[model samples]
Structure formats: structure tokens, C-alpha cells
Target: MGAIGRFTISLRLLLALTQMAAVGLGGAVHAVTQLSRTDTTYTRVLEQEAAGMVLVTRAGLHAHNDSRLLQSLFVERDMPARQRILGERDRAQRRFRDAIARAQDVLPKETAALDDIERHFETMFDSGQRIEAALLAGEDERALRMLQEERLPAFESFRRVAQTEVARLHRRMDEISEEATRKAERAWQVTLLTAVLAVLLALFLAAWLLRRTVIAPLDAVAARMRALEAGDDRAPVPGQERADEIGRMARALESFRLAAIERRRLGHEARTDALTGLLNRRALLETLETLAGGATPLLAIAIDLDHFKQANDTHGHATGDALLRAVAQRIRAALRAGDIAGRLGGDEFVVILAGTDEAAEAVAHRLRDTLNGPVEIEGRLLRLGATLGIAALPRDAGTPAGLLEAADQALIRAKRIGRGGVGRAAARAG
Candidate 1:
């Protein structure tokens, strides 16, 4: 070809590349705008609407719980019982108020809804106080009538408003999800078109350019992101070494993954015992309190391993650990459905059963038999026996603390009486 022909061909290629660049830039700008909007909507839904909804729901539940506790006080004529219920009511109200305050902080735009929740909560709390006073004055009929007329209506109103707020939050979350989906689709379309143009332009250059540098890495990062969202944070993130925007994003996600893993580890360590993998004392007590506040029949069994220290002294710390683990396993195996077992430090363990005294006794017997396990150390056999103390809720005592106290007393009696005996707490005198 002539010099003029070569020059004209070069100019044509340059113009084509320039046009492709312009198109890609415009698509990039549009996609970025759509993604920004989607991100904002998603954050609002998660941080404000969804969090606020949960807090509101919790507040409503605690309010209803307080109402139930108050009603219990009306039936129990004993002063100590009244005081216990009163104390629980105060704790529930504190929790309810805390939840409401958190909801207000998150959903600051929902001021009117939050205000309604606060107003109704105050009304219900005040009515509860008045009814308590009526009961304290020995005016049983007046207390009952006031509870039915004043407190019940206020509680219903509080629940209604809370439910409405929850429903509104749900609707908002749904709308935001839909909007994000649409925006993401539009961005995907724009990106797809830009990719097609780049592919065509690459025909004049290297066809593999866009996929190798941009699309492939982005797809990998996005897949890893989806995995992270699905709660699988163990996978390594891609493209961290690249000195680009994608690299920055990948680095950020890796930090988040590491942080999540640390948080999970810390959470497990906090709740679980290091030796036996049973719930720790704090977690066990929290679980007990949650179950004890309800009307379900509960049984608290306190177990003390008989002659554990003797075995520990004879055999070594390793054999003692093995014995403890074997005993823990037996206790867990002996439990039925809905039963909770926890190590309360050293040779002390506790089991909370949501059943009758008969069921608890059967479990206690099974445990005493099962816990007599032999741990082999240096080809020798070492065994341990267990003693248990059983206490029933609302029969031995009403509250969680009282139940534990009764169970502990029974355990002390069991220890004094025999080597491996089961002792039951005496029924409460109403």
C-alpha cells in the first residue's frame, strides 16, 4: 500500500478506539450511579429499618411479659412473691425502655411512631404501679378491676402500635430490596453493553484484554462477596495484589472477613467452657433466667461428682480431666429433648429440665448410673461417682435465683447424707 493509504488506516483505527472509550466511560458513569444508589438503599434497610423493627418487636414482647408478671402478682397474696414479681417487672421495664431508645436512635425519621410507643409504655407502667398499690392495700377486687380495665387496654394499644410499626418497617425493607434489584439489573445491562462494545473494539486490538484485567477479576471478587454474604468467610479474597479500585475493595472485604472470624471465635469462647465444651456459668444463668420467667414447669438439678478430688489426687490432672469429660458426656447423653446441661466450674455441673419431678428424678438416676465411668491412665482404671440435688420450679420456689438456692441446699444435704445419693428439695409452702 502507499504512504497515504497507511496513514488513513491508522487514523480510522484511532477514531474507532476513541469512540469505544467514550461509550465505555458513559456506561461506567451510569453503572456507578446506579450502584451508589443501591448501596445506600441496602444500608438504610439493614441499619435503620430492619434494626429498628427488631428493637420495636423486643420492646413489645417485654411489655407483654411485664403485663403477665403483674397479673401473677394479683393472684399471689404473699408479700415476698409480690416483691419478686415487682423486681422482675422492673427489670423487664428497663429492658423495654432500652429497646425503645435504641429503636428511636436507629429510625430517627420515625419519630411519631417512637413517640407513640413511649407514651403507651408509660401509661401501661403507671397502671401497673396503681394496680400494685391496690393489691398492697388489700383491695383485691379493685386491683383486679383496674388491671382488666386500665392495664389490659393500654397493653393492647401498645402492642397494636408496635405491630403497625413492624409492618411498616417490613414494607419499607421490601420496597428497598425491589429498588436495589432493579438498579442492579440496570447496572448489569449497562455493563453488558459496554463489554460487548469493548469486545468489538478488541477485535482491532487484543480480544482478551477486558476479560483478563477487568471482567474476570471483578467476577471473582463478586463471587467471593456472595459467599461472604452467605456467611462463609473462610475463603480467601481475590485481587488484593492489583493496584486498582478492585484491589482496594478486595482488601476491605478481607478485613471484614477477618473481623467476622474473630468475632465468632470470641463469641464461642465467651459462652462455652474450655474443658468440657459446656455452657459457661454466665450463659447458663442467662438461659435459666429466660426459661424460668415463663410458666413452663422447670426442674433444676445440681450435680456434684463424688470423690472427684480423691481420684484427681490418686491419678493425676490428666486422668481427672478425662474423668470430668467422660462424666460431662454422660450427663449430656442422659438429658432428654429441651434439657440444658452446663458445667458450673470444677466438679459442679447443672441440668435444667423443662418437665415434671418424675421426669427429673428419672434423669437424675440415669445420670448417677451413667456418670460412673472409668478413665484409663497408664493402663489403669479410674472411676468417679456423682450425687445430684433436684429442685422444681413453682413447687420448690418461684424465681430462678430461688430455684438455684433450693437446689444448692438440696445438694448440700445430699453431700452430708450419703456418698452418691439423690436429694429433692422440699415443696414451697404457699
Candidate 2:
């Protein structure tokens, strides 16, 4: 009972633990998915900001080229070319500012570096304005000298600063990407560890449960079943020890086995004569009736111990019983293999010889000779004689009742003729 209780409790505990493990695995998978999504989002934002920063640096370099062209146009005194260069300068400046604004808005964390870039662009713009003023005042040489010393140097400084900032942003992006990769790797490692542990635990639990719930019980029941099939009803039943469904099945099998044994015992008793260990009257008649339909020829012989009643009256019933047992043994010894002999109450006996009736006369003579010679009971040596009547199947009679009637008639004839003589039935139509 204690073991049964533990089994029940252990089953529930295993189920609970399995559910918990599933929940933990699901949570770990969800965490990994969320981490991957977050990393992807951060990477996209960083890439967009980096692209915008590159656009701003390119625009600044274009504006510086436009400014240098504008000073050359002024020295050539080409009004149309100067006007186009000025317009290009304004468009480039506007494009540069717009790109910077977008980069700054997209990546607010890089504000300090953008501020320094903005400062360099402002210096370059101021230098360009001074060069344009010299051109408007017709100071060509002065403007050319200022272009080399002030505007050129200012534009170079702006370009250098923008490129430096762009490199810095790229380095920052690389750092962010590396950190995200490391984090993703760590999350995957944890998830894999948790999943592997859960699977191993589940396998162990399954194996344990199978052994307890199925394998052990089935093995025990199978052994008992094998014993039952082998006709060993006395084999010990182990299901009585178990408290599960297997135990109930074992109990049922045990009951069935006992019932089968009892049924066999009853059947044996019904067909057997308790006194001489031979077939009873009803069983002998049934055997003859069953043999009546078969194709093989069989002989039915009726036997009677001569003066049996006189012997019982003179020597007592105990002596008669001993005489009957001796006579039955002698009859059995005279019968060939496959011959069936039985007692038909009192001192009368019947024997059926299988295969043919060719040896019927010879067998009857043998039985008569066997019974005529023996008896030593209560220290008294008494000699006995037996009379036999032989009836051949399909020759003297066909039906069991006909055969028995004919054999009885023959026995009557033998008794009339003399004691201890063998008589054969008269022939009849098939």
C-alpha cells in the first residue's frame, strides 16, 4: 500500500515537473526571439544614421568645389559662369545642412561630434563669403591669395573633420554590432543549455515511468501467463502482490485457471468408475455410440464373472470387490493397445477393440483364460471363471444399441451353454 501511494504521487510529480520544464523552455525561446528582433532594429537604425552622415560629408566636399570654381569665374570676369557657381554653392550648402540635420535627428547620441563638424563647415562658409566680397570689389589678386590661404585651408579642415567623424560613427557602429552579436551568442548559449537539459530530463523521466508503469508489470504478468498456457495451474500468481491494473488482471487469470482445473476434475470424475478405475456404465455407452459413426471396424465384447454373486455371498462383499479389481486388471492386461474397456455396473464389463474384429475371438479367449486363474484374498486362494460374448461391428450389428443387445444375447447364450465359455454373436444384415 505504501508503494502504491508512492507510485501515484510520483506520477503526479513527474507530470508537474514536465509541465514546468516545457514552460521554462518556451520562455527561453521567446526571450531569444525578442533579443534577435531588438538587435535587428538597432542595427537598421545605426546603418541609416551612418548612411546619412556619409551623404553630409559628400555634400560638404561638393560645396567646397563649387566655391573654388566661383572664385576662378570671378577672376575671368565671366558673369554667367559666376552666377551658376553661386547657385551651385547655395544648393550644395542647403543639401549639406539638410543631411547633417537628418543624421543628427536619427542619431542624437552623436550630437557632440556633429557639433564639431558643424563648426568646421561654418568656418569654411565664412571664408567663402570673404572671398566673394573681394571678387565683388574687383580685388582679383586679393581674392586669389585668400582662396589659397584662407578658403582652401578652411575647406580642407572641414573635409578632414567630416571624414574623422564619419570614421568615428563607423567605429561606433562596429562596436554596437559586436556587442549585439555577443549578446545574441550569450542568449543562444543559455537557450541551448536550458533546452538540452529539459530534453535530457524528459528522457530520463520517460524511461523511469515506462519501467514502473509498463515494463515491470507486463514482464511479471507475461511470466504468469506463460505458466498458465503451459498447463501449470498451480504456478504461483504474482499479480496478487501488485496494486495496479496488472494485479486485477492477474487475479482474474488465477480465478480462470482454478475454474479450469475444477472443471477438468469434475469431468474426469463423471467419466471414471471409482471402484475399478475404469469407465462407468454411462461413459462406456457414450463411447460406443461415438464409435458407431467411425469407418474403422471395432469389436464390442460383454463380459460376466461366473458365480460372482455366489462368491460374494460366501466370502463377503470385500472379497467380491477384490475379485472385481483383479478381474479388471486381468482384462486390461489382455486388451491390445487402443482397446477401451470399462465396467458396466456389478460384475459386468464391456471392451471395444479398435481397427478390426479379426482378433475378437482370440482376445476373448485370452481374457477368459486370464480371469480363470487368480484370487488370493484374506489368505484364501479362490479360483474364478469369466464368460465372454463377442459382437463384431457391421457384421453382427451396426448401431451401438444393436451391438450391445446382440452382445448381451450372446452372453446369455454362453451362460446357457456352460460357465466360463466364450460365445460369438450370430451374423446379421448390414
Candidate 3:
């Protein structure tokens, strides 16, 4: 698949798995926490019910004592204390009933311990009512006897039953707590296992993807660089399918290598002049065109070697070619970086000077003076003179064709005036 497609697929899969894991973990944690909180609330209710039963037992004992005190003292003021004790007992019974209702909501269906506790509370209430009625009827001995014998026995048994019920509820609560603990431990184990597996899967996928996309490509480029350094141009490397920046870089490098080879081949052809190695007329025209279009003003100096036909007659065509090559080298050495110096075949050469005046007279004078330097041919130095024709851009003519023609006319003028002299082209009027 394509690089982007592969990345997207991997990313989507990872995201989906991650989301699923998160949801599962969240649900599990919430269930565990809820169960734990419910267990705590149920345990608190059982304790509260157990406390209410203890209060009911104490109030029953106090009622029995108040009945005994009423019989022994027979004071009218003791009636209020008796009433307060009865009221306390009633409140405790009410609290016990409320606690039982709360416990029913929490405990499992029809619990045996809860049933026993309810039965014990009913018996205790009936015994208390009988004792209270006998005392109110002024049957003091009968009421005391009933409380000491029947009611006290029932209350004691009720306390034992309530204690047993509390113990049973506590046992059930402990069981639930243990079960919840086991469930929480299991959840933790599962979560840990899932997290470890996820990490391992992520690492494996990351390594695999890195190898496929990045590492492999980098290795290929490294191998290519090594091969290039070892001069093995034929070495094969994987090319990019995408048009991204890396692909563009590879393409650019390939183009540069090809261009370098082509440049070496062209350099040989460029060195030789078709007509004479004196730089062809095509080369001269190209140089003049480049200078004319420049932002800086330029002077075009056209030089024609003096008495070339007579020298050819005296020596040979081979001697003329040698002289031209020597002159071309000398002129090239004398020029600056931006200057253009080239031959127009036969015995003619051109020099383009940047930043020259409109008159072109200054450039002509410099060239005539510099050309006075000797030319070395086959270890023999020859002193030769040349005539120069100068034309400045925008002053002579605006276009390349006009500039060349004007320079040629100036050269003709120099030859007509005198050999080895400088001439300038007249500036054209707007």
C-alpha cells in the first residue's frame, strides 16, 4: 500500500483498540466502586439496627425497675418518671422498626437471621404491654412478678437473638466484602494484562512500521551514497513512488549526476572553435547579447589583429591558429569576473566590459594599452598590435543586433583611420 494509506490504517486500528480498552476499564472500575460503596452502607445499617436492639433491651430493664419502684415507694411524684421510662421504651421500639425496614432493603431475600430478629422483637413488645397494663391497674405485685419472671426472660432471650442476628448479618457482610475483594483483584489482574499486551503490541507495530517506511529508505540512500563515493555509478537503489520532499531530493540528485556527465562531454566541444579555436562568431554574438541586456552599462570592444593575411603568407595557416589561441588565453587572464572575452573566428576577438561610460572612449583606451603586452607562442614571445572598436549599451544601440552592427562599423572606422588605434561608435539619438 501507499505510505499514507499504511499509516492511516495503523493509526485507526490503534485508536479503536485504545478506545475499547478505555471503555472496558472504566466500566469495570465503576462496577467495583459501586459494589464496595453498597457493601459499606449495608454494614452501617446492620450496626445501627444492632445498636437499636441494645437500646430497646436497656429500656425494658428500666421499665421493670420503674414498676418495682412504684410498688415499693407508692409516691404520686414517681408517676412522671414511670411515664418518661415508658416513652423511652416506645421510642426505642420505633427506632428498631425503622432499622429493620432499612436492613430489609440491603439484605438478601428472606434472610433467616432477619426473621429470627423480627420474631424476637414481636415477643418482647407483647410482654412489655402486659406488664405495663398490670402496673397501670394498681396490681403492683402482679406487674413486678410478670416483669421479673415472664418479661425479663423474654427480654434476655430477645437480646441473645438480636446478638445472634447481628453476628449473622456481620458474617454475611464479611462474605460480601470478601467476594467484592476477589472481584476487584480479578479486575486489576485483567487490566494489568490488557495494559501489558497493549504496550507490547504498540512497540511491535512501531518497530515494524519504522523498518518499512523510514529505516529501509534511509538504508537505501546510505548504500547509494557509499556506491557513489566508491565510483560505482551503476549501483541500483529503490526509487520513491510519492512526490514528497524526500522523493524530490532523490530526483534532484539524480538530475545533478546526469548533468555533471553531460557537462564533461560538452566541455571538450566547447573548447574547440569551429572556424578557428579563436571563438566562433556565434560565441561573439551570444556574449554581446548578454552584456547588452545587463542592468549595468557595458562597453563592447571588438579587436581585429593587424596584418593577419601578410603573416599567414609569411608563415602558414598553422602559425595563425597558434597565434589566435595564445591571444585568446592572454585576453581571458586580463579580464575580471563579470567581463566576457571571446573570439569571432579568424583574427577577430570581442571583450564586453561592465560599468563603462556612454562615450565608450575610456574602455577603448584601456584595451589598446593592455593589448600592448607580449604573447608567448612555443616558448617564443611575439609582440603584436590590434585595433579596437568600442560601443556602449543604450548609447550605441538598444538591441543586441544593433549593438553588434554599431561595433562593426566602429571597427571599420578604426581600420580606415589607422592600424593599432581605438575608435568609438556614435551614440544614437532618441
Candidate 4:
């Protein structure tokens, strides 16, 4: 064979080897990034589940204190308080069990702690029953004795165990979060290192392969970048299909871009309600604080869905969730362009209207009318309504806390009078 033929064959062989390495590196980077994301997701689920457990247990403890108060009040023949206490306890028990059930899917490391919590809860309930039996029998003395001996010890034990488990879960979550951060940093480092190696390898082979051909492939990359700058939504960078070094580089860059976008999307999801697509409690507070100095006269309207719990019980949570979304849509429609609305968890929402009481009331009435209309969900029409409480900024109160308090008081008044009624807050003292 001639010298030119041998050179051509050797060049082709080298290019083939380089292409194989590039494909292998690209696959490795993708696999590593995906594994890191999956681990992070699992950690987040554990953290959220642990937090829920803590919340429910605390709520149960609060109800236990209220039941103790009712026990004392029962001695005074306060039948109303007795009934309320029983209802509160029942709700508390349900909440505790629900939290436990939800936590059952948590990571194996948390299993033992959760099991201990469940056992403690059972013990507390057993003692609670004996106390309730004495109360029902009208033997106030026996109830008091049982409460001091059995109920107190059981509650104390449960509280201690539950709180310890909560602390452990919190620590585990912190560790997981820190580990996830490290993994993210490590993934970036690995990807960068691999890209640098690929580029160095490509440069080594550039002499054997025609320099013109090697450089020509980069035109596609430059075009991709230009498309990205022009904000083209049609596949910003198509990499991985080309067998050249430029293809590998584009693939790596695309991965980084996608990772950044995912991070931003996760941040937004954290602050937004999944059901209503509204700002959640933490985000709402931040938004309110941001408006503290903007345009002197602002109004806050606290809204609660009337009979929402009953509706959830009757029509199921799916329907109730749909109702919440429908109400959010109506509220948003009623507000002016600049107004802000947020969900404060459950069936509660708050709206910040940039106007006077008169304007706020008008908006409130429109919202009420919109919410009271029939909602069509899952082939069934349901009637839902809202009770709105309006409080004006600087007029009702100057501070955020004061504004919220005033609005809440008005909401209580609206609910007290009747469902689907609008209430205005009393003027604040200067």
C-alpha cells in the first residue's frame, strides 16, 4: 500500500476510537446526574414526611391539654365544653393516625423511630379512654384520680418520645440536605472534568484528522448558541446525535442548562400551592412584607370557604380540591391587575388589594358572587361559597400583623353572622 493510503486508514481508526470515548463519557455524565437527582428527591420526601409527623403529634398534644381543661370544666357541669372536648380529641386522633400512615413510606432509617411513636400514641389513647369513661359516668372524683395517675404519665411519656423522634428526623433531614448539596457540586465537577478531558483528547487527534473538518463541526455549536441567545424554544441545542467532539460538548452544556432550569423550577414549586397554583403561606408573608412601603393605601382581605370541611367529607377531597381551585380563579378574576392573592393552607386564602375600603368591599362582593356560583367538576355541579373579611391598610392598622389581625376578626364576624357574608374590620386605634 502507498504511504498516503496508510495515513488515511490510521486517521479513520483514531477518529473511531475518539467517537467511542465521547459516547461513553456522555452516558456516564447523564447516569451520574440522574442518580444524584433521584437521591435528592428521596431525601426531600423523607424530610416532608418527618415534618408532617411532628406537626400532627404537636396538634394531638395541644388537644390533650384542651381535654384536660374540659375534664376540670366537666366537674362544673359544662356540658358544652365536654362535647367540644370529645370532638377535638376524636379529630386529633384521626390526624395523628393519618400522619403515621403517611410516614409509613419513609426511608428505612426512620422506621424504628416511627414505630416507637406509634406505640407511644397507642399507650396515650388507652389512658385517655379510661379518663373519658369516668367523665361519662359522672364520677368526677374517679376521673380526676385517673387523670392524675394514668393520663398524666401517659401524656408525658408520649410527648417525650414524640419530641425526641422529631429532633432525630430533623437532624436526618439536615444531613440529607447537606449530602445532596455535596452531590450536586460533585456532579458539576465530574461533568466539567469529563468535558475538559474530551476537549484535550479532541485536540490531540485534530492533526491526524483534517483541521478543516474538525473546525467545521464547531459551526453547528455556534449556531446552537445563537439560537439560544435568540430565545428559540425549538430545541435550544441538539447534541448527542452527532458523532463528533462538538456533539459531546453540546450534550454536556445542555445537561448543565437543564439542571439549572430544574433547580429554578423546584424553587418555584416550593413556594407555590400544588392544588390552587397560588403562593403558599411563607411566600405570601414575604410578598406582604415587600409591599410595606409601596403605595400608602393597601387593603387585606381574609377569605375562608364556608362549610369547606363538610364539603370535603361529603363530596371527597378531590371535589374539595377542585372547589379550592375554582374559588382561587374567581378571587383572582375579581381583583384588580395589581392585587395579589395567596393560599394560607387548607381552605384559607388572603388577598392584598391596593385600594381603599370602598374599593376592597366592591372587590370582595364580586369575589363572593363569583365563588357562590355553581362549580362544575367531574361531571357534577356543586355550589360553593366564600366569607370575606376586608381590612384597610393605615385605616385598619399600619403594620402587617395589625392588618392580618383586623382581617381575621372581621372573618370571625362574617362567619358568626352567616355563611357567604362579607364583613369589614372595625377601625384601628391610632
Q: What is the C-alpha local distance difference test score of candidate 1?
A: 0.75
Number of the top candidate by lDDT?
Answer: 1
* Candidate 3's TM-score: 0.40
What TM-score does candidate 1 reach?
0.51
Model 1 residue 122 lDDT score: 98
Using lDDT as the yardstick, the better of models 2 and 4 is: 2
lDDT of 2 at 153: 84
Q: Tens digits of per-residue lDDT for model 3 on 95-189?
A: 66665655555454525655676677677678668767887778777877887888667767866876665566456545654554554455445
Model 2 lDDT tens row, 1-430: 1122233333334444556676455655564565556554655665565555555555555555555455444533435546766776788678767767877877787778777888887887888888888887888889889889998887788878877887776677667656666665665565556565654677777677767765677677678778888887777667566755456446645655665575466567557766688987667778887877678877889999987888888998778889889888888999989889988777989888766565888788888888888588888888878898988777788677778778878898999999899888987854
Clash pairs detected, candidate 1: none
| Model 1 misplacement above 4 A | 1-216, 219-235, 238-244
Segments of candidate 3 deviating more than 4 angstroms: 1-256, 263-280, 283-295, 358-362, 427-430
Please, what is the whole-model Cα lDDT of each candidate in the order they appear? 0.75, 0.71, 0.58, 0.66
Per-residue CA lDDT of model 4 for 146-221, tens digit only, reads 8888877777787788778766766765675565555555654555465555545666565556444543445555
Q: How accurate is candidate 2 locally (lDDT)?
A: 0.71
Model 2: worst 10 consecutive residues (lDDT sum): 1-10
Clashes of 1: 0
Residue pairs that clash (backbone atoms under 3 angstroms), model 2: none
Top model number, TM-score: 1
What is the descending lDDT order? 1, 2, 4, 3
Candidates in order: C-alpha RMSD to true structure: 13.9, 51.0, 49.7, 14.9
The list of candidate 2 runs beyond 4 A from truth reads 1-202, 205-216, 219-238, 241-248
